[model samples]
Target: MGFDADTGRLDVTPESPAYGTKLRWSAPKLIEAANTTVRGANMRTLNVLSPAPGKAGPATAAAAPDPRPTMPVGPVHTRAPASDGYHQALAAHQATRPERHVDPTIAQAIEAQTHALRELSRRAFPDPDPDSIENTRAKRRRDAKATHAQALRRARAERAQRGSTAAGVQAPSDRRTA
Candidate 1:
């Protein structure tokens, strides 16, 4: 019959020449015809399952069923039983040791070492010139820039190789066998 483009509803029995043609069709027949027409149109327009345009080839086979197990099929069982003998021995050993203690001689030696460390640190650190620091930073940035450029060139070469392989695969000879 007629269709409302805005709402997508069909006018099954309207007062028109097209409506007269539809009125004679049984409901089931009309539905079947509509489904067939829609499917054919979709086959032409949607390209939903096509391997490629303008390239005829065998329809792809359905994928093989997965051989791997998707889930555990049987009740799981463990051969080795859990044990705590090692943990118990460790706990008993830790409890027997003294966790806190101090020796006066060691404490005095530690104080002397701290004083020596402070003196060493005072003599070891010299103030850096800002100009030298800036120069070093600039040199590092320049080296990084060069490395980045090299990486970009390498990437381009790799991409070119991949493209060449792709082009080779799509050559006419490759299609001739198919």
Candidate 2:
């Protein structure tokens, strides 16, 4: 006789009495038998349909108040620290300094040129109303123009303070050839 491990089949010779006999069991009956045996042994068993130990039944447990307390509720606002190194640096940079001497004519000319350029830009790309919601591109262009004009003004002021004239006017060093 030989046994097939994969199929759980036992092969016996034709001469044996139990050679052709097949074995089977009822699943429900087997489960009931196991439960009865476990109950007799006084062992704990979990069955979803049956009442749990220490509880009257499913309905009584459902009707009883929950033992766990409710979670406390409150505002969830968060605040970041007021001061940082970047803010300190910005504050220092924005601090006013003593004014230097700059030619009024040169300053006026620079301001006039900035205004002309701003007008040209406004004509080229007409911006939407300030109150309108969708104006990101227009806003960016305006900001860029303002920043560029401010930079130009600052540069012109610095150059005038250094005794340099407007554009095309050569420096004192450049005036003398080597």
lDDT for each residue of candidate 2 in 73-115, tens digit (9 for 90 to 100) = 9755588656799798877777865567899999999999999
What does candidate 1's lDDT look like per residue over 1-178, in tens digits? 3454444345443334454545455545665566587763221111112122243334422433566878878978866554699778888999998877779999999999999998888778643568877888999999999999988887876677669778884423332110
| Distance from true location, Cα of 90 in model 1, Å | 64
Overall lDDT per candidate, in order of appearance:
0.59, 0.57
Which portions of model 2 show Cα errors greater than 4 Å?
1-41, 46-133, 164-178
CA lDDT for candidate 2 = 0.57
- Measured on C-alpha atoms, candidate 1 has an lDDT of 0.59
TM-score (all chains, Cα) for each model: 0.26, 0.21
Each prediction's Cα RMSD?
34.8, 29.1
